[model samples]
Target: KEEERLRNVDVIRRNGRALGQIIDDILDLSKVEAGKISIEHIDFDLSELLGDIFLLFSRKAQEKGIQFSIESTTSVPSRLVSDPTRIRQILINMVSNALKFTHEGSLRVIFHWKYETTDQFPRSGLLTFQIIDTGVGINDVHQERLFQPFTQAEDSIARQFGGTGLGLVLSRQLAKLLGGNVDLEWSEPGKGSCFRVTIEAVDSAESSQSVPHFLLSETKSASSEDEIVMTLDGIRILLAEDAPDNQLLITHILESSGAEVEVVGNGRDAVDHALAGRYHLVLMDVQMPILSGHEASQELRSRGYCGPIVALTAHAMVEERQRSHDLGYDDYLTKPIDSLKLIQTIRLHAKDQDDVKRENFVATKFSSIDSLS
Candidate 1:
């Protein structure tokens, strides 16, 4: 009976996570459709990113008794400036789709790059990723509808695979946002498929040099079984959330990291409590009763509160993130919050006693110098 109960609980947890992912994908699709999605260009090590992907999918391939490998050419620059997040998303989608369809044979990810000298960028190139999978290939008729929203090649695929069919649509949209596109190079029924994703990337100034090990410290492989252990000792967090479930969830996650969390039901109470108490950081839910998170943050700033205020919202739109910054939020986080991200945000923004004393000392020293001058 206990084992059965545990199994049921596991099923519930898995289903909840699936539902959460579906909701997040739908939000992303809506943002893309509304022309609100934005791309970010930042220097990233291509090798490190591909290594992380290999770590993520290799285990799954092993579990299924299938071979998985990633190969990159020497000409492909190690460092490139592009939207790493979107690129990772697209590649993950492609690889995941490939793995799902593939039961037996091997899967490979080939990275190829072609450099071009342009007036704007001396070192620019097209980075292409080919996800080749030996899977149950799609027919021509099914391939036509692959990019359609909420669609699959065949209805039976959904029944067997259990997917909402938003991955391909989002992948293509995101690739286009990054100045690229995803295409099916070739596929034969009962044989295999190859998906090619091409994006524009400029070689960073430091592309020739290797990325420091310390710089990749945070780039760890994703593991569901391991619990994140981090100490946020002597940190105090103000959590402004109207939802009881969110309040509990955030409080538990923060508490587990050894941080003190005080929950407020509304923005009004949040402002009052925040003013009355000393907090290292504030996690403000964007939409709250009486006063919204934005209004509350503005009020706090107006009242001369200098602590970091991070906006927490369900809105994943780029404009919503920009508005949070415009409204005095130190940072923005979209919900349902990943515990690791929440803890990392707190650790990044929370100021301990030593930090406070140092800042105060610096201010005093600067003010004394100014007075003397």
Candidate 2:
């Protein structure tokens, strides 16, 4: 009974985390549509990210009795300078979409680079991310609006698949933002589909570098059985949220990461409590009664509170994010907070004693739809 209970807990945890990611993705689509999504150019191991992704889907493929594999040419660098998060998301979206259409078949991921010279960056390569899947291929008629926001192939397919159809759209937009585009390589109704994305990239000379915190090892081989795998141990967090449901949800998310958290219902109390106590970070909800999150952050900043404070945004609008930055919040996360990303953001900002925030938002000139025609 005890073992069953533990298994149930783990299942719920996994499902909750997955649902949170879906919500976060939907909000990201909204931001993209509003031209608020920022492309972050950070150096990361591109190959390692793909390896981890393959490991993640390996089990799913086994369950379905489908073959899955990954391949990359040596010309594709080990490390790259670009937005690793967006790139990974694009791959995941494509692969997941492929899996949905495929019943019993094979999935293969191929990566390589093409020599390219652009106006702004002459010595750049167009990294090709090719996803080939033996799935129910996209018909040419339906492919016209394949990358349109809130679109799917057909209503019958939408009902069967049950998706908002944002994945491919977001993937295309993200690739274009990185100065590349998604191209349909080949497809047939019965054969399969091959979708390729080309994005600008430059090789990084360094090998060992920072990785995404959530991209962690599956198991700790060196540690003892009783040892905790991961945690936010000894971290004190202050949460300023007025809504009861969100307060409960956020507290649970933070506490699960081994953080000691205290909550306040309004922004005024947030300012008061934060001033009187010590905390490593603050999760400030942007909208609160009596005083807004931006106002509270302003007050704390005016009083010389230099600690990391992250805003919990709902709208995912440019103005809201800008206000958060202008009013002294170091970073932000949209509401219905993703547990993994919440912890990662806290860990990221917690280590910052300096004023290093996400890179400035860079808007690309080309549109994702433009690449279709």
Candidate 3:
């Protein structure tokens, strides 16, 4: 019975995550259509980004009996200048489409770039991403309107395979916004499809050239001055959740990241705990007995509890988010919760905002915190 209960909880969490992703995707596509999407050019690890993409789609493809792999023609630089979010968005869309159509065989992503070497940094180069999949390819006659906002290849296809159908359109708009372009390189009915994107990239040396600061544990001395901040390990966390399943899932997730968590059933307990305890973070669910998360947060702030407080809610309404923000919540996250984003948000908002900007801080400082927990 215990095992079955845990399995049911996992199923609920997964379905919540899927629904959350669909909502997020719709909002992103709408932003694209309204020409309000922002493209940020920031320095990020190229290898790390691609590796994450590979890991994400690899699991999905595996679940559907499709082989997935990433290949590179040349040595991709470790650090590159580009908008990781948009690049990731494009890759994610292509991979989702590939997985949706492909039943068997393999899905492969190839990275090829042409660069010019300079004395200091690698000059801007054309980076080509080719996604090849052995799937039910679209016919030429229907391919003309493939990138339109509200249309798919056929009505029957949309019924058989469910989607918002704005994925390809949003991908094109995002690629162009990033000074790149997306094209259906080649496709033949019953064979497969090849989608390609070309973008410009320059090498970034900030990571290679900086001395970084890192989170430090309360006990251990730092090896270098950089790793001397507060670590996540041993930090007390108060989780205000009414649902037993969510409490279990969230506790497991936070504990996995080395945080010591305490659970409370109502907003009243949450406020009482926050006032008496020295928690480093709080995961507050919005709807609770006695008082809502908003009320609890307002009370906490009123009592000068300045720690990072994040809201877990299913509502995506603008007024709901603004109300939470106005009520002194530090950050808001929609449910079912995304474990990775949850960790990142905690780590990000736990420390001072300026502290997170140091490009060289490694995550190992926090990993050791797990041992303490």
Error of 1 at 167 (Å): 1.5
Candidate numbers sorted by lDDT from highest down: 1, 2, 3
Error of 1 at 263 (Å): 7.7
List the lowest-lDDT window of 10 residues for candidate 1: 364-373
The CA lDDT of each predicted structure is: 0.76, 0.72, 0.72
For lDDT, the strongest prediction is: 1
- Residue 321 of candidate 3: its Cα lDDT? 56
At residue 369, what lDDT does model 2 achieve? 13
Q: What TM-score, to 2 decimals, does candidate 3 have?
A: 0.65
Estimate the TM-score of every prediction: 0.69, 0.65, 0.65
Clashing pairs in 2: none
Scored by TM-score, the top model is: 1
For candidate 3, write residues 47-141 as lDDT tens digits. Answer: 65675566555545655666677777665566777777678778888888887888877788887767856666556667788989899999989
Tens-place lDDT per residue, model 1, 65-92, is 6777787644677789887767877888
Candidate 3 all-Cα RMSD: 10.2
